[model samples]
Target: MYALEKPQNFHRGTSFSLITRNGDDRSETSDYTSEDEGTEDYRRGGYHAVRIGDTFKHGRYVVQSKLGWGHFSTVWLAWDTQKSIYVALKVQKSAQHYTEAAMDEITILKQIAEGDPEDKKCVVKLLDHFKHSGPNGQHVCMVFEYLGDNLLTLIKYSDYRGIPLHMVKEICFHILVGLDYLHRQLSIIHTDLKPENILLLSMIDPSKDPRRTGAPLILPSSKSKIVSESEVSKDAKASCSDLTKNQKKKIRKKAKRAARKCIGKEEADQDIEVSSPEASHRDDKSNGEPSEEKSRNSVGENSNNDEANDASEGSRGHKRGSRSARQKLLAEVELKCKLVDFGNACWTYKQFTSDIQTRQYRCPEVILGSKYSTSADMWSLACICFELATGDVLFDPHSGDNYDRDEVALGGRYSRDFFNRFGDLRHIRRLRFWPLNKVLKEKYEFREQDATEMADFLVQILDFVPEKRMTAAQCLNHPWISVGPRQLAPSMSENGGSDKKQETDEREAMEVRVGNMAIDGAKNGKDSKSMASPLKQ
Candidate 1:
């Protein structure tokens, strides 16, 4: 077993913090601090400062590393002593509001777990929950089965080029099955559905997985006294006082320069669109790297120049090969995923908040302040499908002047709510109509057939009227989903079995492929319609 390092600042060395919203519509503002949850939150009624090798619940779970941190809680990768497995341990803040939110989430997760005893619902399972007492306060800690990277990570692994049509179908099948179980079986509404909320069944890269790598478990060690942020600050100040004035001046200048560089990089990155309409027009070179042509022109015809050219070409070839390998690996991945982060879920009859869903996936009904139901989730699902097929978001509305123009394109039943009698938007009179199919074909360069099929499937779910939107069960049977790799082939028995046996085997295979039990054609109901609707006006 690896010995635990000395307990220093617990917030150091963590990469980007994972921000999980608790279904609040209000925006939050914070000062730029460290990438991890700021040190200020390490106090009474705040985040519980966790250290590696620290055990919780009578040494049942040993902390290994910080997974991520959200506004309400800090998630850690822990080794379960009794279970002999790795688990995600979520330690929520001890504040009253956060505690209440944790209780609500626990209730929802319990209901989900109880409904799906076999764990076939494609939903995250809540393994255990208990109270953890620490120097900060009493925290409600939840233990969950450790899953792999989320859908957003999968998208990144694809280099934002979007997954193939067959792979997208496979992922969509799982998401729809989960949604069907939640909406049809339990009457629950997952108000917030996005790429970040869906997690793959296993890590895309097996080398990083502890279970696959046979990594030793982190064992519990002697407890160390927890240090508060205030104490750390005092110690820091004392150390600074011991330094010479000249050294302090140099340190201040270095910090200022580093801050400026950080701000400049952030602004530059914001201008670079990962997958936008203008992306095709931009050069295919990564930022901060010199172009091949530029590198060639800068070098003179010498032996050193020849070596540099060879090195550059080799590096470029290596990058290309690596990307190709990753795509191939992604194609072979199991494509199994589970819906997670239920901090905002509620029953259709009793919603926790009207302002639900991320901005990109928000339905037109929710934007127009109309009553939402299970169809709201369907709308979000449609948006996710489009994103998976074509790396760009369907609707990316901005604030102020551009908001009305971008939102009006979504067209909903509540036109009178935001539009004038003349059929013009009240806030912004000028509007531009860009049909979905046209946007996919012209802007994203999707093939005509692919664009048409994708739009037909999405438009049905994105209907202005919420009730007309396709249900998850109906989406599972959509023509677009049934085509490609998901298409069922006639069964041919190797043992030359009877015709009846072959038919039964084929039916079972179809059911397994779709990840749902109710595969009967009649179960789709009236929501399933002919694929003749045009996405373009």
Candidate 2:
């Protein structure tokens, strides 16, 4: 069954075809499901040159598998043979404009790396970058350390469930630290901040690969369906057998020529699906790690593929569907996450745009066409925190004619209070705030205390005025985000640690003030549910 097969390069770049003869070789082409395709399929419509077994940079990294597709780039899980590790390569489209964008990102990443020496906090690390000439075009590829699932993947995998509170705090804390670093130290703003951009630091102790660990990570939200070693061995052999059979079946020379004629002719450009977790699963089945709904609980689930399944929801849809409004909580507690994408990142003095954030997480100032600073990121952070705590978008405003239609229907449309970013309000004293406490308590069933503190924390940033908004540094110092497990410690000072004691007193007093504030806004509770927070000029 020996046969010769030329490398199936998909990109439009310089070709260095490696033809190899093997006894068995076959590959099935997966239809690019727009949702789960590698990043930016909606931006650039075409086939890329990267393929399974494709080696780059003198065989430093060999492609193991594809991760997902995007409009701007396609991601692949490649093995760093030179370093004896796995890495994710983001292969940009060969288009010049996109290549320019990739270069911008590379410059930003270099700045970030040079700014932070030890990787002290949680942020995706960029490893390497180079250009690869392929069939589609000359692709500028950026390499990243291989990571596990994004937060969205974790949520969807839990049967569309929300995560635990303690875990949420942990995840949010790390995100704030990263955001703080970006906003303060780096003087950069991450224009795109969503679940898809926030990746898990690792499934286990990052150094060890999950595949080599011999144990799969089980989410507390969904009980793990562990497969015995024998079953996994059987499935592996079956998959390999199927691959070899397909590879050995030769494509007629005429068929190959016909296929070449249609390369990059596929139109997969569609609006990114933001709220639906399982919406694109059917469309993505043709690609790697195919799974059906019925076999969803099957054993030997590849975590990397699971990440691909989740990355499609990165569009950051402005509306959380009615079905996803209610979410059951997971039981896991040890959660860690890191912010990843920074393609649109710009300096604080020079922002990319006044409209820098995703629709769902856009701040009031941005929506009102006001000048926004780092406070804009804080607003997005607050929205993300709410989603993490409730498993739903906090301020989802539908698009087109339906935008803010829900609020208008409930007599809660209060856009008149918006300021024009120039300190001129549409109406003074006419603006009303639907207390965040009631939104959390009534809508998501958060405890009174949790709701109060979180509302107090969020309100300070979700303000109409950017000047009134809380900074990332202030957020880190807030009692809600700063508070951790209380423990009895031996007195460092014989005087009963007066400074520590004073700090505790202040924290407790702040907590009391937070509760009082929520109680004061109890009258606004009536409008919390139907009230709309999302508005656009």
Scored by TM-score, the top model is 1
lDDT on C-alpha atoms for all candidate structures: 0.59, 0.51
Question: Per-residue lDDT of 181-253 in model 1, one digit per residue for the tens?
Answer: 9999888888878776787778777766666876654452223233333444444456687788898766666
What overall lDDT, based on C-alpha atoms, would model 1 receive against the true structure? 0.59
Give candidate 1's root-mean-square deviation (CA, Å): 19.8
C-alpha RMSD of each candidate structure in angstroms: 19.8, 19.4
For model 2, give the 10-residue run with minimal summed lDDT. Answer: 290-299
Per-model TM-score on C-alpha atoms: 0.66, 0.60
Off by over 4 Å in 2: 1-33, 38-47, 157-161, 204-334, 399-433, 484-537
Ten-residue segment with the worst summed lDDT in candidate 1?
309-318
